[model samples]
Target: MRRVLHVTDCYSTGVGRAVDTIVGLSPEHEHHLLWAGEDDPAGKGFASTTALPGSSLARLRAVRAAVRATGADIVHAHSSRAGVYARAVPAGAPVVYQPHAYKLLDPRLPRAARTAVAAVERALGGRTDRVVVLSEQEARLAARLSPGAGRTVLPNVPSLASPGVRAPQPDGPRRRRVVMSGRVSPQKDPGWLAETAERLRERDPAVEVRWLGSADDPELTARLERAGVSVSGWLPADALVAELTAAGVYLHSAAYEGFPISVLDAAWCDAPVLAREIPAFAGTGLLTVADPAAAADRVLEVLAGGAVRERALQGARDLLREMNPQVQRQRLAEIYA
Candidate 1:
């Protein structure tokens, strides 16, 4: 069986979920994780899991040591930070790097910083055997950044539970909640959400805006609260399911992403989706909005429950088939071959 050694700095949030999905994609292969996060990914079924040293230099040294000790057939790095670690270290095995979302593409970064990040990626490109991407747009981006690395377009599957038909809420005016799930960060562009929530509230006081994840940024949290957007800080599984079940729409506002697992979960839960326009979502069948203003209008249209909502819901349903484990299993086997 092929053995994959995964290197990652993020194993607490979305990246961790992505790793879980990857492990399940190819059951015939054994997986090992060398991670920097404090919490171990319980139930991930790794052959072995190691925590990296605290410092950056130490982390790199630890990766080099792990590469030799594991005798891995493939070194798969998750995210850009670990991409640096895995590709910088000499691995006797082939290296497969998945940036999750390229840091260089983040709009918040200064042009000069983005350029520097691109240069680092180009310098390390030769060490990468393949770059795993979730979409064709990402594949083309990888081709430009990692010229020497081959591209592997692996369909992204949801790692979260489906939650089936939404639990019926108490009979009322029908909760008009637009929900966004994820920690408050620049990537999520809480500013856009704040504006959208305010505009939505002005249009209809009955409309509600809620976030399914934590309020990690104090400033953004304040803005969201001011805009009448409620934050459900890291809800329990049952509570999350309840919220998603009653959700009129799931809004994804990431300025950039590797195609989020939350979107997949939202669709699986059967909530109509409204995401911001970004390259990662191009041709994904999901309806994307140009701006928060447009998003507010779309959310209202979706909540109205008509052809627009049905069409929006249908897109996500159709896309779910691409993420079936069996489909991914076949692709993984072919790519690693």
Candidate 2:
């Protein structure tokens, strides 16, 4: 059996699901995953995964040991930290790095740190076999940073099954639901989302907002609660998908992204989108907006009538078929083999 090792700092449910699909199709491929700090329950059966010590050095050492033990032919790493650690593993295995979003996009990262990462990519990229990206925009960015390596587009993999949904319309005139899901850091900018929701509420008092994400900011959570937005941190996959399907409209309030799995989830659930006009988010037939207030207006307009919702749902369904996880895995098999 050909062995592969996937390394990442943390395991997202989306990532776990994708890995599961890959393993299902190509059982001949023995896959092992390693991450830092703690094991993710969602990652079970995706591969035999190990959670290493928190320190970078310790994590790298553990990954190296896994590489040796697995006799891996390819090392696939996700995120910047994992990419660096994958590179540190012995050169016997071909290395492939998948950066969901480049480390430079992190708002908390220092400018110097960003520059240093770029320099390191430039230096080590030649030794790397391929850099896989979830969007064409990310592929372009990777090419610019590591001109010596091959940049391959391997778009995000979303589930094929429809998200079962249910909801109660709150007691009000314009009872509509708006949903946003992601990590609640500055990149996601929950403040902007709250502001957008406030504007929507002005036009329609019954407009309700829900956000599902890792709550990185306690102050933001308090502020959102004050503004009447329901915030839930790290929901299970089934519950999260149900919420996406129940939402009258899904909002993509991110500043930047390679290709957000949440947007794909919304599409899979036949949910309409009022999304920021980012290059990666193009072609989803969403109500694109530059202004947050205008975004709010668009969302309200789409949710006001059942006919509009029906039309939007059809569009979302079309997009969902185009990006199905099974088809995406077939594509990856071609790339990997």
Candidate 3:
């Protein structure tokens, strides 16, 4: 059996979920996780190592020691920060680096800072055995940023109790509620969501916009509330699933994304999805809206009851088929082999 060591600094977001999925789905392989934070999401079955918050050099030393102690055959790193540390260390194992989303793509960063990050990534490319991305657009971006890097696509799959199970829709009038799930950050474009919520509220007084996750920005959360958006701060998994199941539509207005797991969850839950026209979702067959206003209009249309909602639900089913976990498992095995 191949021993794999998965390294990650952030264990609470999409990166964490991806790592969890990989370990959980691939039971044939021996997986050891090296998490930098105290929150141990790797529950029961696997061996784990934790590192206290420290300088990069200190963390690198800890990771290197972990690699040797575990005698891992392959070292897989998740997210940007962990990628930096994992690629920098001479771990004596093949390194697989998956940057859930490249930091250089963050619009909040200044141009020069983005360029510098690109340079660092390019320099680190030689150390990476495989650069796994969530989508084709991400692969192309990685190629441009880090020329000569070996890149591959391994889409993130949702973790559902029953992989293909569909939620039953109520027969009566649908709730005039729209939901968005994810951490409220600049990438999610909370400002646009706030604007859209106000417009949607004006268009239909009964329309309620609910955000299922918490925001790092208190001011942005307050702004969304003022604009008549219900901010449900970070619901537990079962609760979040319940919210999505009850909602009429799922609206995603991210400025950019690698592959949003929440979108995948919505698709699995059979929620009608209306997302921004971003490259990351280029061929996912998801309905795309140009702006928040357009998204709001789409939500209104769905709430009004028509073929649009049916079409969107069909599209979501198609998306779920493409992201099938069994298919993903085969692809992952090929890569690891």
TM-score of each: 0.93, 0.87, 0.93
- Model 1, 116-154: lDDT tens digits are 999999988989999998788788889998898889888
Give lDDT tens digits, candidate 3, residues 233-292: 867666777788888998897888898888988887778888888888787788888887
Model 2 agreement with the true structure over 181-266: per-residue lDDT tens digits: 87676777788788888888788888889998767688877777777888888786677766776788888888777777787777
Model 2, global lDDT: 0.73
The candidate, 1 or 2, that scores higher on TM-score is 1
Q: What lDDT score goes with residue 278 in model 2?
A: 72
From the highest lDDT down, the ranking of the candidates is 1, 3, 2
Off by over 4 Å in 2: 37-43, 89-91, 105-113, 159-175, 306-311
lDDT of each: 0.82, 0.73, 0.80
Candidate topping lDDT: 1
Q: List the candidate 1 regions with Cα displacement exceeding 4 Å.
A: 161-174
Worst 10 residues of 1 by lDDT: 162-171
